[model samples]
Target: MTFNAEPFTYRIAKSGDVHISREGRLVVMVRGNAAAKLAAALGNGDESDQQLLARATGNYKRGNERLAGSKRR
Candidate 1:
């Protein structure tokens, strides 16, 4: 079996932490707790309230990166 290379769309914006869509429609908007975890997976520094917020809410986007076991800082 084969899967589509681009099955889903991922957007990271300051206005809406993270926006996920399939077939060009907003499927889910992750904020609060969920967003925090996703943001960390994208690449976040240390675990702290302020750091999480910065990662969760900002124009910064992690679109070009992939989830990895570890990344060089």
Candidate 2:
């Protein structure tokens, strides 16, 4: 018996959206609450995965800051 897990990949789109790529092709678009949730999890959660997690953390932090900035105006 053999088992293999699918590869995971994602990128931030031009409109500040998140996307997951599969099999060398763009597959899904992650936006709104879904994107925010993923960002929160990837950031706040204590995980060892550095690269993607760091990106997510940065995104979440920046988004919150932007939201706050807009509110002040």
Candidate 3:
């Protein structure tokens, strides 16, 4: 099965707060030093960055999976 490559997005506010969203819904707001660190890590914009965002929002996998062919048609 296919999954979204970039499911999470982020915004940096003027106040240096990091706002992370999933599908247009705000999931977390990071501030201060933590926000700075997150911003730097996200700069790469790679697969690992996506995974970091997922973990930050506690959205990582929880053992629920099924092969594409297993889906009832």
Candidate 4:
């Protein structure tokens, strides 16, 4: 028999919190340390499958000094 996996979806609320849901029901709204962890992971991980996650929670540091716009002094 073939198997199918359930799907999970998530979004970031206007209050800067992350909400995770399965089957259209909210399972959890991650905040505090949990939200922080998710944000950190998004910054470091490949997120082709998690476009919403990045849009909602990723806070990445700029990698290049020249492009970041600051004097080297």
Candidate 5:
């Protein structure tokens, strides 16, 4: 996927320290937790919180419908 370089930013933080970067996607690690891991658990990459939530919700709903339909067959 192609993203606009000027329009996107990445925020990396650990504890109280934070780093802001214009790079699209990345991994920020502090101790054992990384931003990339957090994003994966939430679904996809460094998308905005709202965007990730919407995508995850849509994926869940679609998966549920698919499973339900399969079970009915």
Candidate 6:
């Protein structure tokens, strides 16, 4: 599976809240120390930052696994 983080974007509110959005839709609003930490981590806006955003919005994989079985021909 491949992950594309381009659709994720964030903005810092005046009250120090981090507003995370995906595809132009708001996903989560982070506040307090967590918001500060997230803001710091998102500085570079690289792959790792994307991953952090994904995790913050509960968009990451949940560890459930199952390989596709061979189809009967």
C-alpha local distance difference test of each model: 0.54, 0.53, 0.79, 0.55, 0.38, 0.81
Q: How many backbone clashes does candidate 3 have?
A: 0
RMSD of each: 13.8, 14.6, 4.9, 13.8, 10.4, 4.1
| Top-scoring candidate (TM-score) | 6
Candidate achieving higher TM-score, 3 or 5: 3
Ranking by TM-score: 6, 3, 1, 4, 2, 5
Give the lDDT ranking, best first: 6, 3, 4, 1, 2, 5
Which candidate comes out best when scored by lDDT? Answer: 6
List runs of model 6 lying over 4 Å from the truth.
65-73
| Residue-level lDDT tens digits of model 6 in 20-61 | 998899999999999999887887856777788888887556
Give the least accurate 10-residue stretch of model 6, judged by summed lDDT: 63-72
- Give lDDT tens digits, candidate 1, residues 1-73: 1232444455777854767665688666778778766755654323443334334444333554454445758
Report the CA-based lDDT of candidate 1 relative to the real structure: 0.54
Per-residue error (Å), model 5, residue 34: 7.7
The 10-residue segment with the lowest total lDDT in model 2: 43-52
Residues 30-61, model 4: lDDT tens digits: 78777766655543323442544433433422
Looking at candidate 5, the ten consecutive residues that score lowest on lDDT are 22-31
Residue-level lDDT tens digits of model 2 in 15-69: 6677766566765667888786665555332333334433543442344555764
Q: How much is 66 displaced in model 6, in angstroms?
A: 4.6
Query: Which of candidates 1 and 4 is the stronger one according to lDDT?
Result: 4
What is candidate 5's lDDT per residue for 1-73, written digit by digit as tens? Answer: 2233333333444453223222444223222344355344542444464343333233323445557657563
* Model 4 quality (TM-score): 0.44
